[model samples]
Target: MFIVMVAPECAPVAKAGGLGDVVFGLSHELEIRGHAVEIVLPKYAGMRYEDVWDLQPSHHDLWVPWYDGTVHCTVWFGYVHGRKCFFIEPHSQDNFFGRERMYGYDDDALRYAFFCKAALEYLAASGKRPEVVHCHDWHTGLLPVLLYEQYAQVLGDQRVCYTIHNFCHQGLTSPEVLWATRLGRVDHFLAQDRLGDDTHHGAVNPMKGGVVYANFVTTVSDTHAAEARYGDSACGLGHTLHRYQDKFGGVLNGVDYDVWNPETDPYIPAPYSASTIERKYLNKEALRERFMLRKSWSPLVAYVGRVDEQKGMHLVHHALFRTLAAGGQFVLMGQEQKHNGINGHFQHLKDHLNNNPDSHLELSYQEELAHLVLAGADLLVVPSLFEPCGLIPLMAMRYGTVPVVRATGGMRDTVFDRDHGEHADDRRNGYVFQHTDNQAIDSALQRAFGLWTDYPEDFRSLMLNGMRADHSWHRPADHYLDIYEHIRHK
Candidate 1:
């Protein structure tokens, strides 16, 4: 199969979140399976140039239509994660992807719209017709619309598999923004069931357009698919998903063991596998020393992710104090968005801690620190209010660190309660909570702490179970291949 992935981010080169990890992991796995996989991403100014192998200009002047005129783009080709990749570098005065950051710009809608068009222009001009044009997130949501409505003659009738990683960010923009995409505002395209944003008057929802036009739509997990269709988690797109229920489904995201495995991890102080789990404590000691934490036998609970409202930052804050109250050492390594007020709260909490011996909070994301935390900590907390598919918990488990997550999205699909499931004795890998409240998380934590404190052997068993579990990309890649084959035939 010839598959081409058009996404905004790809790991180790340009990444903002789990979306990049998914793009790289899935593409790499597909290539390993003997499929010809290629990726197309914008050549953002801040991308890690050193990671791209043999990057050279494929096309110097690929003209792409803009709002009123045309802008030429430089198409570059390279290999990332051992798969072919093409980068579209727009030579426009607007500086679409020339910013220092990957996202959170005022002109993101217009930028991505231009990117979608430019990616198609590159593919068409390069004479490549992929069997599956996998579009990811709202960043490439407009690709399916452009491929079918605008570039069908050149790009052919390729099957588009639109994967929605985060439904909350639907790329809702002014109706006038469609001009940037060169997708004119015709009544057929502006219909309520198509690209129109029914909830927001005169707005265009790119994610909705992808879901409607693509042959198949998938979220990160089966439970999240259900939530997006029947629950309020889709942020007003539930009806749209429910309307296209026949073609929409979910597949749980997978972790790239090449980067996350404890046995081969170079970031951790001590590398240990499930059988030699006793040596994992060396890393715990190293973490305590690195964070200036007082040495203690109590469980070390860690939280590593973005600190935001949707991530249940309130629960994270509550967990920090609760962990301390329960005689556990707490370590948090996360980045906070400035717009959210949680940064101030965490800053104040940090000041109050005053370098407390049992607790440490770092307000920024350091990839190395995350690996150390996961490998060293006994428990990893993921109290997301709504998670599409969290990769941290999966990576944490691979390091033999038991995850304590709220039952939502992929967390529900992956993390079984240590004491609740029918065959939990054998299948349970972590602790699961039901609600988004502090009490619910506290209850799960106390059980985890109790198991570690009193029943040491059982705690070891739990950790071993998590370490033995297979959360790799192999199965999920096969699931995606099945989707591609199904769409190809249909």
Candidate 2:
């Protein structure tokens, strides 16, 4: 099978969050399974070239359609982590994708719009057609629309699959921006209910466009798919998803063991496995030292993610204080959202930690520190209001760190509650809370702390079980392959 993945982010080279890990991990897994895989991403400024293999220029030139006119762009080629990569660069004063960061620009809609057209232009110009084109998130949502509209002739019978990593980002833009796609007038799509944004009337939503046109759609987890269709976490696309329920499904995102495994992870100071679980404490001491904490044997609880309200940062803050009162240590590694006042909250955590003996707070995203914390911490916290298949809990599990997560989305699917023991005795991985309230969080923490304090053997058992669980890409990749074959046959 020939597969092409189009995403705005890829791990190790260009990454913001789990989306990057998913793209790079899935592509690499597919290629390892004997399928030819290629990934298309915009060549953003300051992207580390050292991460790309045999990085060089390509003769491929693209004429990307804009609202007013078409702009020329140069296409560069490279191999990232064994998968073929295409980096498109637009030469215009607009400076699309020329920023230091991958996202958070006012003109993101325009930048990604240009990227979508340029990607197809490159594929058409290069005369390469894969059996399946897998588009990830809203950043590449327009690819499916472009394929069916403008490039159908050149890319014949190429099935498109769109995966919604985060439904919160619908890529909504003004209807006039449709002119840039060269997909004909937007009125027909709007009138026919093909590319409409039900939440915002008369707007052009690229995600909705992809949903309406793509052969199939997938979210990060089966539970997340259900939520998007029937639950409150749909991000205002429930009607569209429900209408296309048969064509929409969820597949759990897999953890890249090569990068996250405690036994071989290069980032962590000490390599330890389930059998050598005591070695994990050395990493704990190292992490504490790195954060300038007084060495102690207290249970360490850590949180690793964005400090947004949706992630239940407020609840996490509450949990942190309670944990400290209970004599348990806490460490947080996250960045604040702009204008969200999370910076002040994080500062408060830091101030509390300054007086506390074994507490630490880092107001940034440090991948190396993340690994060390996962390896070191006795428990990882994720109290999300509504998570759509989170990866942090799974990563923590791989490190033998029991996850304490709110029962939502991927966290609900992945983390089996040790208290309930619903699954096999050996498979109960972590603690799960039903509500995001302070009381619910306290109950979970009490259970976790009890296991760590009085039942050391049981705590070790839970951690070892989580470490031995299968969270790798092998099964998920096979699921994706099945989806591709179904699409191709249909």
Candidate 3:
């Protein structure tokens, strides 16, 4: 079957967070399942055009009536995990994506609306009618809206499935989007939930419209699905998600072992497998010596991901101050990417942490460094207030680095607290805290440290257990195949 994937971000091209990881991981697995998959994303200025310059040129310019403007669509073709990937680059005059950030835009609705319409038109023109048009996140929410409003009659046979990687980034359809994209018929979108909750108290909400319109909807994890069904973790779209609970579900994300495997990985210093467990320790000692970490007494605490508030930076920062004071070796491998503002967020963070850079603290966003840190660390910390299937902790677990994460969404589902007194065997993956506070992080860190220092034998056992666990996409890809077969008729 031919699958069309539309996302706002992808890896090795343009990325800000886990959204890119999901796009690359899932697309790779889908392709492995004998399905021809293609991806569509905006040609942001930050995209690595040099890497994908070989994709054949296959796009054109189209104008929307009354908008007094033209939108340029450039098509690029490639393969990810043996699956054909087609990427779309949308050119905007006002530097829509020219900046070095992924989010924070007032005109996002207008941009992606034109993007969805253009992709459908391109599909029709190129004679490439996919069996499923899989739209991801609120960024591509307009696909279902446009399909029902415009493309359904012409491409009525194709089914549309929308995956909500993050429901918060809605492409709100305001008067600008309604008029600029040439979507057609404002009354049709407005009268009685035609466009779902794109308008809430005069404000537009595009994420809600996706839940209402898609043939099938999926979150990143089963726990996230449950949280979204309730009013807790929906990020203001809980009621909307609850309304569509029947068709909504979650697929616990899987890691790409090809990129994360310790044995074959080129990033880590000492390559080791499940059998050569002792070599990973050498990597840890090498990591300590390379980073100039002097606190060999305490268990090394590590962090990797976006250094933003949502990642519990407020708490992680506080815990860092406290944990380091308590004689713990702390290493953070991350970088901050501010969307669009007069001032840069990275500069602000550097000004705060620049006082000392030679200690256990290292701030670099390079992908290879992230893999090295994961392989070398004793405990990986992910204090995300809300995580959409975090990949770092999973990678950490694969490398025998225990994770200490906040028990929320995917974090709650993946990391298990072995010290919780029951299911000790199954719960030996990592440490977890429920409350999104520094207090919780402090306690979890203490418990993880306790296991690392006090119970060296048990800690080694836990590491061995983590290495043996199967977190790969092998099973999840089968589940996705089941989903595809179930929705094949649509």
Candidate 4:
């Protein structure tokens, strides 16, 4: 299968969110399954040449909106994880992706609009008309629109599949965007709702436009797919998804085994497996030492990811107060993003725990240190308000650490409840909370704490079970191939 993945982020090159993890992980898994999979992402200023392999050149045209000047970007290619990926070298001002953050730039809409144009231009220039061009998130949402309006005329049957990692990011642009592309046949009809038609709240919605144009629409998770059609989760864009429900579906993201392997992890103090469960304790001790804490603790619960409110940071923060009060220790290894628009309640938790000694909150972010914490921690926390498909819990489980997560989206599909246990300590994978309240999180924590405090034997067995579980992308990638095949045929 000659399939191509078009996303804005990729691992070891340009990454900030789970989207990078999805691209690199899924591409590798698909390639391993004997599928010719390639990824297309922007070559941000942060790219490292040494991280990429088999470098090659492919020309592309990037049109600058404000000026009539043409920015001819040199499209570079390198193989990562046995999958070829394309990077557009801006060559122009390079100010488009000069900043660190992936989103929220002053002219991100313009930058991404240029990128979408470059992607289409590159596809035609490179002469690689793939069977399927799977576009992820709004970053590459315009690909479907371009394919249908322009490219489809030339390349008759190149099926396009646009996967929405988050529908919240609707790439809205105006008629100026069309002019910026040098597209002569600009239709005023496209400015409407169905075909980039209606201007959204005065502007336009590019993500929604892709939804209406793309042959198929896939969210990150099934639960979120249904919820997105009509709920607060949609961020006021659920109606578009509901209208296109026949074409919309969900495809869960997968964790890359190579990136999160316990056997050869350079970050952990000592690598151990399910058979050698005793070695995991050394990692726990080392993690405590790294954080400058006492080695002897009841049960060390850890949270290691973005400190955003959507990740249920407040619930974890609230849980910490009770966790310490109940004679347990809590460790956090991620920084919070300041200045929230509508969802910024986690700041309250941070403010409340400023002078508090019991709550050990470290305001930092380190990948190496995170790997150590995952290997060492007795329990991992994932209290997301609504996760499309989280990878932290899956990473935690890989290192023999039990995951206590909120029951929603991928969590529901991945993490089994306590009742599924074959033994008293049989449900050792960790705890689960369904509701998005403080009580629900606390209830799950209590369950995890009780098992660690009283049932030492059961806890060890559970950790072993978690370590033994295979959350790798191999199986999930095969599932993705199935989806791809279906998408291609449809």
Candidate 5:
């Protein structure tokens, strides 16, 4: 099987979030299974050239159609972590991909539009017809649209499988941008079931267009798939997603153990496994010293993510205060986004926690601290209002840290409470709260703390069960392979 993955990010090279991890992990796993995989991404100015091995020129002086004109680009080829990677660089005159940041440009829609067009042109010039064109998120959503509408004959019989990593960001742009694809008039996509969303009247929804054209649509988890089809979580694309219910599904995102395993992690000071779980306290002590927290035997509760409301930041604050009141230390590792007003509140909270004897908050992204927090903390809290597929809880569990998460999306599918599940003794790995409120979070936390302090044996069982659990790409890779084969055969 030949798979061409088009996405905005890839791990250990040019990553903005978990999308990169998913792209790199799935592609590498597929290649390891004897399938040829090639990734196409934008050559952002900030991308480290040193990370790309055997870098060389592949295509120079490539031209792609933009709005009413042609944009010249140069394509670079290299290998990142054993997978063939292609970087499309738009000409300096266009400046589509010339910015230092990977995203958040005023002309982002145009930037990715050029990328989609250039990717297809590169494939056509190279005469490469992949069996599966796997496009991730809205960044590459228009690839399916372009392939189905404009370059159908040139691209040959290629089936596109579009994965919606996050539906909230639908890539809405002015309908005028569609001219760059040379597909047709804006009226062609103005239909209710197509690119037109009721909220944004004059805007084009690239994700809705992709869902309408792609052979298969997948979300990050089964619960998320269900939510998008029937609930408001789809962000107004529910009509399209539900219309294609037969073709829509999901696969839970997998954790890359090569980067997160406690036994072999290079970031954490003390790497301890389930058998030698007693040594985990050394990491806890190191984290306390590093964060300048009080040295005590009390449990350490931790949170690692963005400081935003979507992640249930309010609930986290509520839980953290409660944790501190209950004679426990709290360690938070996160970065605040400036545009979000709630971040200012988080900054004030960070300042207050910094002055406390039993709490510490670092307001920046430190990958090493993230690893150490997961390894050192006794409990990891993920109180998300709506999570597609959170990796933090899984990574924390792998480090023998029990998770206390709200029951939603991947957290609901992955974490099981020892007191609630049918086979509690054998299946439970973490604490799960149902409601998305402070009371729910407090309940889960108190349960975790009680398990740790009163029932030491059950707490140890939960930790060891989580450490031995399987969150790797082995099963997810097979699931994706099945989806690819199904789409190809259909």
Candidate 6:
């Protein structure tokens, strides 16, 4: 199968979050399985060029239709992680992708809309009819729409598999922007069943269009899929997902074990596997010294993610104090968007906890430090109000760190509670909770702490259960290949 992934980000090159990691990991695994895989991404100014091999221009002039005019783009080719990649660099006065960041701009909807059209234009010009043109997140949401509506003849019979990483970001923009796609009859797109935004009237939703027009739609986990279809997580698109339930489903995202394996991770001070689990304590000691935490044998609890409300920051704040009160140590490494005012809140917490020797807060994300925190921590907490598919818990579990997560999204799929799961004795890997309140998270944490403090052998067995579990991309990639084959036959 010839598969082409059109996404806004890909890891080790232009990564903003897990969306990038999935694109890279899934594509690499597919290529390894004897399939031709190619990735198309915007040539963002801030990409890590060092990771791209044989970087050169592929097409000198490719014209893309824009609102009221056409934009000329230069397509560059390179090899990223041994996978063929194409980067579209637009030559225009708007400087669409020349910004310092990959996303979060005033004109994000328009920029990605233009990118969607440009990606299809490149595919049509290259004469490639891939079996699957997998689109990731809202960034490339317009691709499926444009592929079926505008470039159908040129790009013949390309089955689109649109994966919504998070439904919160639905790429809502004015219906007028539909002109840029050169899609015939803009009024047709304004219909409620097509691209219309359900919540914001007189607006178009590219993600909605993908859900409606694609051959198949998938989220990151089965629980998240149910949440989007029957719950409130779809951000007004639950009805749309319900209408397309026959074509929509979920495939749990996988971690790149090559980068996250504790046995070979160079970022940590000590390398240990499940068999050599005792050596993991050396990393715990090194982490305590590095974070300036008081020397003790208490469990080191860590949180590594964004300091945002969606992450249940309030729960994280409450958990920190509760963990300390329970005679445990807490370490946090996360960053918050300045506009959200959560950064100041975490900063105040940092100041308040300054005199406390059992807590440390670093208000920014450092890749190497994240690896160290995951390696050295005895317990990892992710109390998200709603998580689509969290890779942090998977990574923490891979490192033999017990995860205490709310039962939502992929966390529910991956981390079964040590005592509450159906097959607890066999499938139990971590602690689980249900509600978003402080008490719910605290209850789960107290259970984890109790086991860690009293039943040392049980705790070791729990950690070993997580370490021995397979969370690699091999299974997820195979699942995706099945979806591609199913769609092609349809």
How many backbone clashes can be found in candidate 3?
A: 1
Give the distance in Å from residue 370's predicted Cα in candidate 5 to where it truly belongs: 1.9
lDDT of 3 by residue, 22-133 (tens): 7787788777766777887776777666546455655554333226666666676754434455666666566666766656676667666666777777777677788888
Candidate 1: residue 84 Cα off by (Å): 2.5
Better of 1 and 3 by lDDT: 1
Q: TM-score for all predictions?
A: 0.97, 0.97, 0.90, 0.89, 0.96, 0.97
lDDT of 4 by residue, 215-249 (tens): 88887777777778766666666777777788888
Residue 148 lDDT (model 2): 89
What is the lDDT, from 0 to 100, of the residue 357 in candidate 3?
A: 34
In what order do the candidates fall by TM-score, top score first? 1, 2, 6, 5, 3, 4
Clashes of each: 0, 0, 1, 6, 0, 0
Which pairs clash in model 3?
Answer: 198-205
> What's the TM for model 3?
0.90
Q: What's the C-alpha lDDT at position 86 in model 2?
A: 87
Candidate 5 C-alpha error for residue 139, in Å: 1.1
Local distance difference test scores for all models: 0.90, 0.87, 0.73, 0.74, 0.86, 0.90
Count clashing pairs, candidate 2.
0
Candidate 5's TM-score reads 0.96
Report residue 194 deviation for candidate 4 (angstroms): 2.5
Scored by lDDT, model 5 comes in at 0.86
List where candidate 2 sits over 4 angstroms from the true fold.
Answer: none
Cα lDDT tens digits, model 6, 102-211, are: 77787899899999999999998988889899999988888988888788888888899999999988889886677666674767888998998887888889899999
Cα lDDT of candidate 6 equals 0.90
> Which window of 10 residues has the lowest lDDT sum in candidate 2?
184-193
